[model samples]
Target chain A: MDVDTDVTSGGGTARPWPIVDINPEALAALESYKKRDPSKVVVRFKAVGNAPIMKQNFYKITASNRFQAVIQFLRKELGWKAGDPLVPHTPPRFASPQLVLNKPQFTYINLAFSPAPDDTVSNLFKSFCTDGHLIVNYSTTAAWG
Target chain B: MSQYGTTRGPPQAAKDRTTDYHTALFRRLSWEGTVPLEIRVDPNELPANSDRGLACYFVQAPRVSYLPLLMPEIRRFLMDVVFDEAASKSLKEEDWWFEIDDGTLLKWHWPIGLIYDNHTILTTIRPGPSLATTSTTPLRLILHLASPPTDKLLLAANAEACKQAFMGQLKEADFIRWGNTKRMTGLRKADQDGLWEGIKEHNFEEYWRVASKVTPTTTANRPQSPGPPPSSVSMHGRPPSADTSAPPERDGAYNVRSVPVRLYLPDGPVIQDLVPPLLEDGSPHTLAHFLNTHAPLLFPPQPPAPPPSRTNPNPRPPSHQELAYPLVQGILAPLDSEMAWLGACLAGADGWVNVCVGISRK
Candidate 1:
């Protein structure tokens, strides 16, 4: 495979740091320079399938915050509890009404895969942002494979 | 062997057999690995009259297993000693969370070994003469039964929620490696269930039977069935190869589209990058290449060469300086080890190479 040759070719050239060392204070300062003020990044939410759309699709979030903040924000906006079912429905006569919780809503980046809740917003925006905005896709059902 | 009908030449067949053996060995070792743990309940959460002797529970935890899986047994052993009857009755499985001695919240979704590797990076720092005691000491964790840190950790509500999260990670890894999640989502329901069942039951054969289907193989002898084009926008351009549908390989060197790598930096942040398996010229990407690209400041591009072999026959002396060490599967992986092989063999149950980088104090 000549893998050794390939390893050495990309070995020596040290590129300038694209992503700064993960210092919370330094990261916040660096992000502030990229945006207007207060270290916020623009996040655009898009509804998938029959999911309800938000009145304000674009929200400013702290760039250093983890992605879990976005999920919590969307859940609050949709009036859905953390573990609540995506669609509420009436109970059957034969079964307990409280036990019929449908699938929960899911969030994705680029409609490809679910980013971990711990993933930092700045990292996601740097890697997958489109048109200078981090596009977050939320769906009530399994929208994409 | 007979199924190939001599399509595979003798030497290639031998190489394939060797690779398969090593992969199986690695998986087996990973599955069987265990970490000695000294688990104790947070003293503040314990009842006033709790028995001090029974507060701590020691056990060897399976490295690949989730913390939630051991909750019932651990709670049973220490519940009476820690929580009063009323508190015990009110506590639920999701109410419990674990923390290291330093109070760092442990992510339930991460494998136990990965959690240990991430937190124990300081133990691996070379040239530190005083780290011997800490390195050999059993990992001490505090179990909290109240006020789980919801913001810092995802709520592992129940076993089902934990399984779903694991599946979500697997799909993420598959998508990162193939630029799509079709292979993971396309698995038959039974096979998909089997993958989780295997992990829950710790059955190596059952897990690999389905995992092998999703993981790309080095051999390019599979059928040329071009699946549907990727529906979502590809972050990286597709490799210049005609058979885009085929399981990842442009040649022997460039096998997988991208290696799903999550680097746990010593400081705190976890860096997940879309690292291709090979460099531009199709050479295997090594651990050094990955670190140089991602955390260049910690791991300089051209590390100081080891003192000349003739002068200092022992390349690794007592005072040798190592800027950083990348630990994969709880072992110090050589810098020259190829990412392709590590991703294939040492990836966590979620199918991502989780490298814990330990920066030296010096």
Candidate 2:
């Protein structure tokens, strides 16, 4: 279950599953990236993939809501308008509020994504697992700061 | 007569009563002046060099040694109790067992015996007696400060001094707290007369930490290289800070109290780099120096190979090339010009037959 959102979406893609449930903190973290490059976003989406994806019940990225549709969904979820802070001062680092898992061994996992990075920025971040590989539709990086 | 109780004044009456009660108490605990401390090595108490000395100060200079992991006040108390000129049997063998009431023990010091079966406890040597000669010992604990100490202080740097100081501290407090004296008292005794009233509670916590470091004189610290590669893959070698809780030992288990202590070691050309080599078999710095001096030497310069002369040629090949033409094929291998010397050798360049043994000498 998404920690931030109680809303549920169908397990697989309904074409770029609208970002109606994006986390507020995650939304706040992406403002600057949106302003800099609005067209193509190197975004991340997590679907219940404990099992593998098969073509029998196919899923793909993009629907009536294009990939950019997540941007507005994030804005409304986090209560933001354009010109909001690019990065929140404090990012949520924990998966749960209380450390319920105090075993001898306890660690955490997280989700992160970026808007389409320029060639220079793209080379620096090497993804390890799970890919939506950003589909860049907008290229206004010339004016990005 | 006594309720008017006898005619002795309260002050006189109090002194007389105390005198009668303590006449036999701590009979063995007397020192002309001050007493020296008890020092325990990791597992055993150190041999005492003097007959009537008190306080166990580290012999190594503060800059070159460790900061005393044992609290200084407890160390002083231990020396005062165990290093007494007369307390040889202050805390009789095993247990003399005293019952302490709760009141009127404004200040008192008694002998304590630690549970030697599961504990590392010992006493100081009187003169000719050595630590190896005794069966009692104590674990030495020193307070770890976040920042460094300002003035010169004894950090348990030397094995000999550290052991003695630790023993002395425990011995002193044993009488007043952990000793049988407190164990034998009635539970309802005045909260004030319990012998433990004289002990500094903060001081006891320090003793607990010290006692914890004494892990039954383990010989397990010897340095060893990584064993034959593990049967399964391991997630080691990753830099720390990535996971602060990662265990320090290769096997992921180590003594809780005895951790990776970062005490300053002696300075030397061989061990100058600040790497903490374990003091396992012997003096760690000394062992490092010896290894630096005697480890295996690397490939020696083949006497400059005397630059083989162009005029000299070899006698014969152990086997002729499968191909009829030997010279142009360059000894039957795909080696480039840079290895002409090898080609010359296989052409029996040095009068010896060359053969590729499939590179499987082992």
My TM-score estimates for the predictions, one after another, are 0.73, 0.15
Error of 2 at B88 (Å): 21
Each candidate's fnat, listed in order, reads 0.19, 0.00
The DockQ-based CAPRI class assigned to model 2 is: incorrect
Give the local distance difference test score of model 2: 0.22
Cα lDDT of model 2 by residue, B302-336, tens digit: 12233345664442324321111001111223222
- Over the full model, what C-alpha lDDT does candidate 1 score relative to the true structure? 0.67
Q: Where in model 2 is the C-alpha error above 4 Å?
A: A1-89, A100-145, B1-290, B293-362
Q: Candidate 2, after superposition: displacement of residue B267 in Å?
A: 4.1
How many clashing residue pairs, candidate 1?
0
DockQ of each: 0.12, 0.01
Q: Write the per-residue lDDT of candidate 1 for residues B1-362, one digit (tens) a residue.
A: 22321212223442352344455677778778877788998888775667766789988877777887777788888665665677667777678788987778888777888877876774443222212224555788998877788777785645676777788788877766766788888889899999889888878889888888887554433221233232112336653453465443332323456778888765466776667666654455788899888776666667354786777876653443345678888887888877876777778888888898765432
lDDT of 2 by residue, A73-142 (tens): 3323223321234656634322331321221110001111222111121221111112434322111121
